[model samples]
Target: MLTSESRRRDFPTLDGRAYLNTAAEGVPPLAVGEALAQYFRDKQLGMDGRVPHAAQWEAARALTAEFLGLTAAEIGICSCSSEAYNLAALALQLQPGDEVICTDLDFPASSTPWLQPACPATLRLWKHRSGALHVEDLIPLLSPRTRLVNVSLVSFYNGFTVALPPIVEAVRKHSPALLGVDVTQAIGRIPLDLRGADLIVSSTHKWILASHGGGLVGVPKDRAKEWTAPAGGWFNLEDAFGPGSFEAVKSKPGAASFMVGMPNYPALYAVRAGLEYLRGVGVANIDAHARPLVLHCLTELRKLPVEVLTPDEPDHIAGILAFKHPKAAEINARLHAGNVHVMNPTGRLRVAVHGYNTHDDIERLLRELKAALAAV
Candidate 1:
C-alpha cells in the first residue's frame, strides 16, 4: 500500500535533495520526532512516569518480534549491534581449541569479539571469492571444534544478499556450532524469515527509519532453555524494586537476561514509532517500490566507466548497490555539493535506495554523477 508519493511527506529532509545514503544512516520521519518529544513530557513526571516509559519499551520489543517473525519471549533489547554481539560472545563462553568462522567481507564488529585476547576460541576467516560468498566455501570451514559462525545477511560494502538457509543447513549437518547472523542491513529493507538461525541481531537506525539505540537480538525457542546471560543487574532481577530486591540476585530467564541495565528509553520511543510506520506500509510493499529504483540506477551506471559490484541477479540483491571508482572520494564530495547524497567508502561508491525515493531522485543522481566523473 506504500507509494513514493504517499511516503515522501514523511521525510521532510528531502527538500530538493537526493538522499541515497540509507545504508549509513537513515533520515527519521516526522513521527519519530514527535515520539521523542512525548518521551520528554513523560520524563517531567519523575518516578510517576516510569510505568508509561516502560510500556513504550515493551511495545517496541513486541513490534520488533513481529517484524522478525519471532515470539516476544525470544527477543531482547540492547544499545547497538556491537553491544548485542559482545553480549552474545560472552554468553557463548568459547574455550580453547574451539574455532569461530567469520567472513573476510564481514564488518569488524561481527568477528572482533571472538578475537579478544581473553577469548579462548581461535578466529578463522572464510575468504570471499569475487566479492561474493558461496555456501560450498563455508562448508569446509565448519568442523566439530567450531563454536560459532558469524555473518551478515547482506554485505555492508556491497549489496550481496547471502543465501542463509543453505548455510544454516550446512552448519547443522557439519557440526554442533551455533549460527549467528547480523541482520542490520537486511531487516526492514527485505522480506526475511530469520527463524532458521540460532542468534539474530539488528539495529533500528538504517532501514527501519529510526534513530539509533535500540539493538534487537532474537533466540529461537529451542535454544532458550540453554541460553542464559552471563551478566546481571537490577534490570535482570525478578524483584527489581519489590521485597528481596537486593537479597539474592535471581536472573530472569531467556532473552530478557540480555537487558543488563536501564534501556535507552528515549530511542526506544522512536523505534516504536518507526516500527508502527513500517507496519502501516507493509515491508513487502517497500521492497516492491525499491526494486525499480535499483534497476534504473544500475541500468544507467552500466553506461558509465565504473565497475558495478552489486550482483545483477534479482534474487541476490535488495535496496543497496555498490560500484568501484578510482577517484570516488573527489566524486562523492562533488555530488554532495550538488545536493546529491551517496557514500564512497573504501573506494567504492554505495547507492542505497529506500521507500521515499522516486524516479526524480535517480535522475538527479545520474546527472550529478555523470558530471562529477567527467570533471574528475
Candidate 2:
C-alpha cells in the first residue's frame, strides 16, 4: 500500500479540513498549481507558435491515453465532458425516427443534448433498480429503432456503479446500436478498461484532480470515419497553414478530429501534473486506501436513522457515498458549519472520499452526523 503521509502532502487542502467532495470537484495538488504558474511564466517570455502549444497539448493527450489504454489519436480535448457529449450528439448520424436510450439516473449533461428538440432523434429512458441500470430492465426498452445507448458508468446521486460489459454485449446483439459512456464519475476513482464501448467521455476535474477546462473523448479506431466532425476549425485539418490548405487537407481520423481552436495550454499542463501525481501513487494503491474509507462511512451511516443509498459490496462501490436523512438539508448545513465539506444533491448528502481521507476523518464525520441528527 502507498503511504498516506506522502499522499496527503500532494493535497494541501486536506491539512486544514475534511474534504469529502471529490465527486463534485477534486482538489488539485500543489504541483498542478505550480505547473500552471510556470505555464504563464513561459507565455510571458514570448512563446507563441503552434509547435510549442501542440507539443504540450499532445503530451497531455498521450498521458491521458496511457491512463485510459488508448492511442493518442483516439483522444480529443474538449472544454468539459458536456461539450464532449454535444460533439458526440452532433457528429452521430442519427436519422429521423431513430431512438437513443439513456438512463433516468444520468447527469443532465449526458441526457439533455440528445433530448434537444431540433435533434432528429427520440430519447428513451431506462429504469433504475436500486441505483443500478439492470440489463433486463433496459432490454425491454430497446427496439429495432434504437440506434445508440448512453449511460453513466456510475450514478452521481447514490454512487451505484453500473455493470457495463453485459449491457454493451446486449446492445451489440439486439441492434446495430452505438455504445457511449459518460465516465465522469468513474474515471480515476475506479478501475476502468473502456474497451466495451465505442465512444467514452470524461472530464478531468472529478477523479483526475485537474482544473475545470480539461476533458477527453475516446473513439475506437474502426468506427473513426463514421462520425463527422461536429464543429470544424483550423486544428481539425492537416497542414493548417500552407497555401491551398483548405483544399488539400483532410480531417484527422479518430476522435482527435473533433478538436477545434486552441486549448487551454496551462490547464493541459496542470492536468498532466495531476495525472503524474496519481501515477506516483499507483491507482490500485489509491483504491485500497479509498475503498476502506467508503465502507467505513457506509457502516457508520447505517447505524444512524438515515438510509444508506450506496451499494454494500466492495465490488459495486466507488469513492462516493450518498444517503438520505429526514433532515438532510439541516444535516448538510450543520456539517458545513463544522467545516466538513460534502455534496448535497437534492436531498441526498453525497460524501466523496479520496486517498487523502483517513479513518479519523470518518470518525469525525460520524460524530458530527450523530450530533446533528440528535439536535434535529
lDDT of each: 0.85, 0.80
Error of 1 at 354 (Å): 0.8
TM-score of each: 0.95, 0.94
User: In terms of TM-score, how similar is model 1 to the real structure?
Assistant: 0.95
In candidate 2, position 136 carries an lDDT of 86
The RMSD of every model to the true structure, in order and in angstroms, is: 1.9, 2.1
Model 1 accuracy (lDDT, Cα): 0.85
What is the Cα-based lDDT of residue 135 in candidate 1?
Answer: 89
TM-score (C-alpha, index-matched) for candidate 2: 0.94
On the 0 to 100 scale, the lDDT of residue 39 in model 1 is 93
Backbone clash pairs for candidate 2 read none
Candidate 2 regions off by >4 Å? 1-4, 48-52, 239-250
Among all windows of 10 consecutive residues in model 2, the one with the lowest summed lDDT is 1-10
